[model samples]
Target: MRLTYQTDYALRTLLYLSCLPEGKLANIQEIATVYAISQNHLMKIVHKLGKLEYIETIRGHKGGLRLKKKPEEINIGALVRMTEEDFYIVECFHQQTNRCLLSPVCQLRGVFQEAMAAFFRVLDNYTLADLIQDREMYEQLFEQKLIEIS
Candidate 1:
């Protein structure tokens, strides 16, 4: 039930934006360096997030990325749903090409479904704000003191 690195990067990107001062912008390269991640991979995530309207991007000088919505407006569950295309917890969970012989009477499939639902249900309880509750902690972790965003 692990999220792909793409989704992981998206979440990290969003959290980083949310941590910034209001109206401040962060460059993709700066964020990549702070997180010790590849700028190329994060560029894709940033593009997808921009298309989803979760963040806004500016071009030219003084251009970067910023959170378009408030942290409380960003639902973790919905974000995961958009980033994660496949939710098939088991072979029986998928409708297409589910060759499970026990598909007709598989209690295991239902159990897995319930667990996955529960996973999202719990995630639904949280928003980006919840994850960034400890802004000071994240600030320390990122150590982004030099690249000041004015």
Candidate 2:
């Protein structure tokens, strides 16, 4: 199952913080500029992340954001589950699926469930630390540092 844009951004933001030396601030605007995303949207994501205690925010001069916990402590599966609201693989898999006549007998539900389990299994193998290990390659792929406040 493909991730939503919001999950993608959240992961990217986490990965950015994960790569940092630790206890360093990463400005929201810098992340937005680096990712070519809207600052407004990034702010919302940051607020949610901070609320979850994944990251900490600081205001005023010489202030920005940083991770509250280490990268290894952040479970990818948990992260996705927290950030993603829908895990449906198909239209028939959605909550309001009265349209599917054979849903009761259809093996699609089991298949989808297996598919989702496998997906989480893969994600579970990698922590945010593992994701940002190849820092230069990651920076190159994203065309910017994960966190750049200064």
Candidate 3:
């Protein structure tokens, strides 16, 4: 199953923050501009990330966002679970609204469950730090130092 734009943005946001030199701060507009994403949408993501304690935020003049935890500390699987609203891969996966006739004898449910587990297993293998191991390449492409957190 494909991840929603929200999850993608959250990851992007984390990546952007992680790539910056330690203790650097980036404002919403700067990050949105860098990724060519909507500031409004990024604002929601930033807000949730703050509440989740994944990032720290400060308001007013000279205030911005920074990572609260190291990139390696951020678990991709856990992030997906937190950001993904639903894991119902199919109609049968949900008991309250499932109407599939094969619900009584479907092997697809087990398969989907296994597949999802595998998906998380793979994601758990990496972190934001792992994603930016090629930091020089990323920095060259982005054409800036971006942000840093201490």
Residue 77 in model 2: lDDT = 90
> Which candidate do you rate higher for lDDT, 1 or 2?
1
Tens-place lDDT digits, model 3, residues 35-150: 88899999999999998899999778888999999989999999999998999979998899999999998898999999999999999998888889998787665555334310
lDDT of each: 0.89, 0.81, 0.87
How displaced is residue 121 in candidate 3, in Å? 1.0
Using TM-score as the measure, name the better of candidate 1 and candidate 2. 1
- Residue by residue across 1-150, what tens digits does model 1's lDDT show? 888888899999998898887778899998888777899999999999999999999998999999988999999999999998788868887788899898998799878888999999999999999999999888776665435431
Check candidate 1 and list the clashing pairs. none
TM-score of 1: 0.91
- C-alpha root-mean-square deviation, each candidate: 2.8, 3.1, 3.9
TM-score of each: 0.91, 0.85, 0.92
- Shift in Å, residue 72, candidate 3: 1.0
Q: How many residue pairs clash in each candidate?
A: 0, 0, 5
What ranking of all candidate models by TM-score puts the best one first?
3, 1, 2
